[model samples]
Target: MTPLRPPRSPLGRRFGHLVGAYGLVALTVLLFLAFSLALPDTFPTLDNVSAVLSNHSVPAVLALGVTLPIATGKFDLSIGYGLGLAHVVTMQLIVAEGWLWPVTCLVVLLGGAVAGTVNGLVVAYARIDSFIATLGTGSVMYAFTGWITDGARIVPGPHGLPAAFTDLYDSRFLGLPVPALYVLALTAVLWVLLERLPLGRYLYVIGSNPRAAELVGIPTRRYVVRAFTGSGLVVGIAGVLLAAQQQIGNPSVGMDYLLPAFVGALLGSTAIRPGRANAPGTLVAVTVLAVGLAGIGQLGAQFWVTPLFNGSTLLIAVGLAGYAARRQLQRRRAQPSRPVPEPPGTAS
Candidate 1:
């Protein structure tokens, strides 16, 4: 008689599945290596890494903000303009009004939350399509931003901004830029909220099927509003940090971040937790973008190269996300349904 052998465990099978699922992360690694090889001296250094982290942190935050709304099947185009407006408001309150920095920060953040609430009400209560609603609000925000600045920058008085205020973005914690820490902390908070909380589940359910969520008594409208509000609040936080980082309200800086932010959020859905927007996945996506951009810059790429890269990546991300979703659906369909068990004495 042949000796009995144990069957393979699910762990081995899951390892293969996880590798396939995390292909984007693998691609990121490959891109990093390619850059390091291409620019051996400059690309693999700590200074380059620091620059990438410091520069991308704001986009990372904005990406996280948009991720929340996207999770609920909504989009907030206003985040870019809202970021500019919030920072402009912060500066106006500080330089023109001479308000305390801390107090000004609070007011700016509150304004952001209020902006979010308005967006929520428009999309949820008014029953407008989120894309159109946010686009309208975003345009209005840009108008307000331009009106506030009159097409000029908001510079601080000769005394300069408070050390504490500037420190929020410029200071280092554990040998890394403080804004990077903010990114990590926010990612952690969002991960917990989305992956480990009831609210997260509700949002995903609504995104997956609003009608089914309504049938299951999930208060879809209220939750969608909350999602947009949360996004607004996060965008406000990003604006504040942007103010700290720039130390001047440029009015035009916010729009530059919009494409990259959405790209990160959308591309992220194809990895880690495929077919869903998740925090860890977004972080990974942002890292890939940062690495690729930094490497390209070091290679003496032209200024226009940056936007070209971003736009192309956005298109690719969308295509990959759709492909991954279809693949997931096809795999599910391929699995055999449970066969009806034979009645007693009916088996062959």
Candidate 2:
């Protein structure tokens, strides 16, 4: 007979869980420290800190947006395209049409919602695979982007974009970049929505098992639609921020963020709440990428290094995420089954 192992103490189990949850966070800190030590002058400076935050905030936001649909076991490949169109439109409205900054932002956000709704409708009602559907939608959005820009960049006039618009991306808040603050606020909101709300639970359930969720009377399709819509809205916000920061809208800028956003979101699944996508985890993942890239750049890495790193990280993250998910499922299977309650008036 196999020897039985001693049961773990509750304290020990809790400690283990804590480490598992925050291990990536710890890794991020370690990477920062190591780089700071290695490149004392540049890596540890406040200027470098601000630059990294300012440069990466948009990608971080996009990563967070992608996390929602991922939490529902879906992907939003069209986010980059949505982002491209949203920002271009923002520029077209504000720079070309002389629309007020506030009005332009609102319209762009609404357009994002509409785009997300179309993606949701196509995926849920049409019963198409999210990967293929989003890709198709994304291509269409890219086409629209091209049409809007006429394959050219949108440069503002001599007066420049409104200060209010540029401030959205350029201003600092309490010594931190405003865009970074936006990322933090968005992360907190998504954390609450995904981890503390019934909506989150419903989405998680659907993600884990659609049939099981349906059997439990959860509206999986509607929730899936909601997930995609939320993603689109967040993408819209990021696009506006991108436009504000770039000041000159490039039709192809959206795709630049795509890889890093996905890399962050996927790698994040293997940390924090392992086997699951969470907002906090996504933030942590983006930090890791940002730090690594900043450090590499400071080390005089080549231009191609960034994409290579992102692509490699993406593949590894996917593998680890899949392995972690399987492990979680196995753990569930290993647990003792609960006894079913006897029906009322049917048993003693």
Candidate 3:
């Protein structure tokens, strides 16, 4: 008699599924290797890695922040403009008004929160679509930025700023750069919040189905508003960091970061959870872009290539996410409506 074949265990199946979900990471690694091989000493150096991390940190943070709103089924296009305005406010407070850096940071953060609140109200109470709401607000914020700076960069002297303040961007920790550490720490905190917390569950539930969440007494409105507010607060922090790193607040700077931030968030949805915007997924996506862009830049690629890469990645990621979601829905619909029949004469 032929030997009986053993059934695959549930754990093995789950492990395979997990591996399949993270295939993007493997692709990212392969791309990194390709670039490393092409650029040799230039692309794979520690200094290059540090520069990529430092340059990408602000966008990574903003991407993570934007993930919350996206997860809750809303978009905040205002983040770029908010960053521009917030940075200007921070610089004006410190250089023009002579306020302390700490106080200026606090006030700018609060201003961002206010902007987010306005966005939330427009979406939740005014019954406007999130994209439209944020676009309108973002335009207003851009105008404010222009008015504040008069379309010029605000440069501050290093005199009144504390070393610790500048060190937030400049210093290194444990042989790694400070901005990289900040990204890692922020990723950890956000990962825990999205993966382990009750609020996280609520956010997901609302994102998946707001009406159902509301019917179940989940306070969907409150959570949605909170997500935007939290996103704004994070953008505010990023703006402060950007000011520190650049030592100038230019009206044109913030929009340059927006494409990468959205690309990161959208690409994140196609990995890890395969249709959900999660924190760790965003980190991986950001890492992929950072590595890719840094490598390309090191190769002396034209500046336009960066946007081309980001745009293509964003489209592909969104397409993959949509396909995955459709497959999930189909599987759910095709699930067996009744239990399979046991052997003849088994218990009825």
Candidate 4:
């Protein structure tokens, strides 16, 4: 992981730190190159790239979704269940109830918001641990998911789904997959929100030091709620995209993504802005996962390998995230302290 060399000069020191901060991006490039070189006939093709982007885009969205809750130092374990519920609900409305796709999407998004609100309320007001609360809510969501589809897949009508609807996922914008564009757009929005916006600043403050944030007049509870709500909304977006992309409602598919999303979010906190969850960092982490998985799958990895990879990565991500946080704290402690000025009257 120490890919960059430490330099003695001041400017070189800064450059080295910068390189360390964004090493994941460099790893992404190296990974892509390695796979391309290793699987010359398959991995280098545009079709392969397009397929990977299209397939992993939903998971990327989910990871981005989870990043919000994590920012507030709260985990929304319900997102996977929320995604499944949203997916099934989308298809059920469209196919069973004969609702228009636009309306269905809107309703589902709103439902997602409501679900998030519930999570926020439970954790913020009820004093439930976010982990336990979200897990319980997620299970309820899954039960509703099964109830909606009766544990059966929701297939489209004889005419299939509306072309315009499927086009949400299937269409290309300038020869690139549209879902990939969604990830980029969401990333930019989150980057602006978390890195540049006051609201995001409040959440980060709350995450790093809740009592300090409250003493400074930030509404820590409200912001934490907002964080989970945002995560829920993103989960809905992913679900909508999943329905469009899949064109079938598989009641159990949502759990498949839970690991990778967490993996991406946790591992992401170790890069770009180490010790803090960030949009660009999450994207870089997801890219690494996508590339590595694709390369291995192409090399004839068995079906179980995907889960194994995700599971192992999740463990590593958790460990690295803990280490990064401690390292950051140590760095702060090691910094030279500035002298404080005395009160004018007292000094006189």
Q: Pick the candidate with the highest TM-score.
A: 2
The digit string of per-residue lDDT tens for model 4 on 1-348 reads 768855369887678667757888898999999999999999999999999999999999999999998988899899889999999999999999999999999999989988998999999989899999999999999999999989899999799999999999999999999999999999999999999877777777778778877776677788888898888899999999999999999999998889899999999998898888889999999999999999999999999998999999999999988888877776767788433222123333
C-alpha positional error of residue 35 in candidate 3 after TM-score superposition, expressed in Å: 1.5
Q: Spell out the clash pairs found in candidate 4.
A: none
Model 1: per-residue lDDT, tens digit, 1-348?
Answer: 998877558897688568756877998899989999999998888888888999999999999989999898888999999998988988888888999999998888888888988898999999999999999999999999999999999999888899999999989988999999999999999999999987888888788778967776678888888898888899889988998999997988889889999999998888888888888889989999998899889899999999999999999989977776677666657787433222223335
Residue 206 shift from truth in candidate 1, angstroms: 0.6
For model 1, what is the error of residue 167's alpha carbon versus the real structure, in angstroms, after optimal superposition? 0.6
TM-score of each prediction: 0.90, 0.93, 0.89, 0.92
Checking candidate 3 for backbone clashes, the offending pairs are none
Give the residue spans of candidate 1 off by over 4 A. 1-16, 328-348
Winner of 1 and 4 under TM-score: 4
**Model 3: which ten-residue window has the lowest total lDDT?**
337-346
Clash total of candidate 4: 0
Residues 1-348, model 2: lDDT tens digits: 999999889899789778767888999999999999999999999999999999999999999999989988999999999999999999999989999999999989989988998999999999999999999999999999999999999999999999988999999989998988999999999999998877888887788889977776777889899999999999999989999999988999898899899999999888889888989999999999999999999999999999999999999999988987887787668898443223223436
Per-residue accuracy of model 3 over 1-348 as CA lDDT, tens digit each: 999978669898687567647877987899889998998888878888888899999999999989999988899999999988888888888788888788888998898888888888888778799999999999999999999999998877757456667887999999898988888898888888888877777887778778877766677777788888988988998999988888777987888888889989978877787677888888989999999888888788998998899899888878876776665556557676432223223355
Every model: Cα RMSD to truth: 7.9, 4.0, 7.6, 5.5
lDDT of 2: 0.91
For candidate 1, give the lDDT: 0.88
How well does candidate 4 match the true structure in TM-score terms? 0.92
| True-structure lDDT of candidate 4 | 0.90
